[model samples]
Target: QYNCEKRQEVKHISARIINGNEALPKHWPWVVAIYDSNDTLVCGGALIHEEYVITAAHCFVNQDAHEFSVLLGTTLRTNSSQCNNTPKDCNIQKKTTRKTEVPSKEDEEYHKASETQVICVGVESICTPIQNTCCLFMKDIAVVKLKTKVNYTDYIQPIGLPKNCEDPPASSTSYSVGWGRIFEYYD
Candidate 1:
């Protein structure tokens, strides 16, 4: 009688995009979203290799890989207002040397008012793990090599890794955004 799956996603919908040179573990350079088979959201991932996705490593356990879905190159979870296969009605001022002239203030403001028009962020490449690693949570780190490389586009590209493999300072602020109070944390 109701789309219960959709309702659940509304409560669990926490997805993100990683575009440009944003450093990760908080800010993703590409848009990453984890969803259910019916297109309900769950969490985000940082692309580590072609198909290798580095996530909490605790997110994939107790679930069938076939039941999970990942959508890349978008900030907002639901797919809406995508025209010409690009975002539509975006609310931000998008400027590039390629787009020489800026739109009028009214038009600019109107676009800014729209939530779907901004450009899509990109993740160079990411993948599914060989198996779900949750209970043990062996490594907080994870890598997902893609089944096939994602086609890159403007305003989106691969993120650069830390220059040194060494860990950052403890004072460094890192954040994790995901759905479910059922999450497992690691060092």
Candidate 2:
């Protein structure tokens, strides 16, 4: 019963994600699957509850702190080349040269790059020791905690995973806007 609903739901989400709506902004808050020097997608997770993100347990088995960086509010692909044709308001870039003297190290030239802000996960508790419980299998699923509560802005939001539905919807499409490698390979 639930399996059938999940499958349909997945299809619905997939279609909507691929064919987005005209009224929605492109950015989406999500977990970044940062692979190591060896280049492997270790695990997957979702950001839920302020100060914590959910991910797979195995994602932390043999990974380093530096190797992982979460890029939230992004689409599946990181690159924005294909999204170039998007509206001007969505992308505002200006090239100006300015200099500021720093008290500590050295002078620096500032190029004001106006990009959409980056939403970071706080990651409250990770790999915390816990005793096993019923109905909770230790699988590849964990949460990331954010340092601050995400502002409830129209431009940034968490992906909605509807409950009670057995499978993912096959029509209520959704998409993840990120600076990933979507355009480089797409036709």
Candidate 3:
């Protein structure tokens, strides 16, 4: 079940959302990083349940369960300093692999067990409506089941889903979050 407290609003010069800015550990705790075997951030996911993640269906194209690991409790993609600064219950799973990616050789202290264990037990994609003409995209969502249950922390928890499938208010400020490619490099 969900077990995270509300994020405290802090006054800052930057806008509410911005690129390249490091996210606060407590803010949007349900947002998780989906990584590949080499520790590369492939996509971003939202924890909907202890053993379930909701992400873009395109991220799973040609990807396998064994090639992915979900990382939580940390904001830095490859570093665990954020977790190290947290209180108790900071544990990770340690497993050896052929060529795992470590943030840096000198930062061996952060080289701990992969904190999150994730496996795509099953994937359910939202079916698109049939169209006569070329269709770009439709219902581009998928739900992934985690093989191992996750230990909920202040940095890792599930988000509240709407009870009914209704469109949001037109003037609502929705957010798009991810650790994928950033606009900084595009220019």
Candidate 4:
């Protein structure tokens, strides 16, 4: 059983944490980076299934599903020399020809490494509770279906969801993980 009790002191601050430490590789395997057509980091998402990701609906505001891609199996958002010496063990080749364009050769090399097998997949469709107004904060969740199914690896996995709607005990601890601006002044 997982222990849910609080183990750290509480510090209230801004939306993003200040002076946050970097997470170790594979620490949060379910986390994925969402990118726009221009290959810009737009938002972060959670892998819930082989071909599905969950993210905030607002991320899709004025965005085209076809222009979005999901990257999995890597902890570092930007390419690093650390991943350069590793073997390409991820099964990204099988889905390379789908609607979503694979990452450029440079991008592919940037995310490739033995410790992590990075793969990029295109967004096939997006579903939300509210069809017309997905930008609303209420029901802000959006489910994105990928054009190809991603093969799981040590660095790529789905997060387990709660089976029932039950509040946790008062003493339980909760955590939030995502990619956001590290410094408030810098965009």
Estimate the TM-score of every prediction.
Answer: 0.46, 0.40, 0.61, 0.68
Q: Pick the candidate with the highest TM-score.
A: 4
Residue-wise lDDT of candidate 2 within 53-138, one digit each (tens)?
56655555554343443434432322222222232222112212332112222211111111253333323235533435543455
lDDT by residue (1-187, candidate 1, tens digit) is 2221111111122333222121221123344555544444556675443344566555555655544444554433342222123422221122222321233454454333432332322223333345444445455544544434544432223544565687768896444443333334569
User: Candidate 1 at residue 53, lDDT?
Assistant: 54
CA lDDT scores, all candidates in order? 0.39, 0.36, 0.52, 0.63
Better of 2 and 4 by TM-score: 4
Q: Count the backbone clashes (under 3 Å) in each candidate.
A: 26, 51, 0, 1
Residue 93 displacement in candidate 1 (angstroms) = 35
User: What is the clash count of model 2?
Assistant: 51
| Stretches of model 3 off by over 4 angstroms after superposition | 1-20, 79-136, 180-183
The positional error of residue 9 in candidate 2, measured at the CA in angstroms, is 19
Between which residue pairs do clashes occur in model 3?
A: none
- For all the candidates, what are their Cα RMSDs to the real structure? 14.7, 13.8, 7.7, 8.7
Candidate 3: minimum summed lDDT over ten consecutive residues — where? 117-126
What's the alpha carbon RMSD for model 1?
14.7
Point out where model 2 deviates above 4 Å.
1-45, 62-69, 76-114, 127-138, 164-166, 169-187
lDDT of 4 by residue, 1-187 (tens): 2212221222232344555544434567788887776666678899988999999888897777887877777656642222222213321222222232233454455334423466677788988776565447878889999888877766677877765867777996556676654445755
Evaluate residue 21 in candidate 2 and report its C-alpha lDDT on the 0 to 100 scale: 26
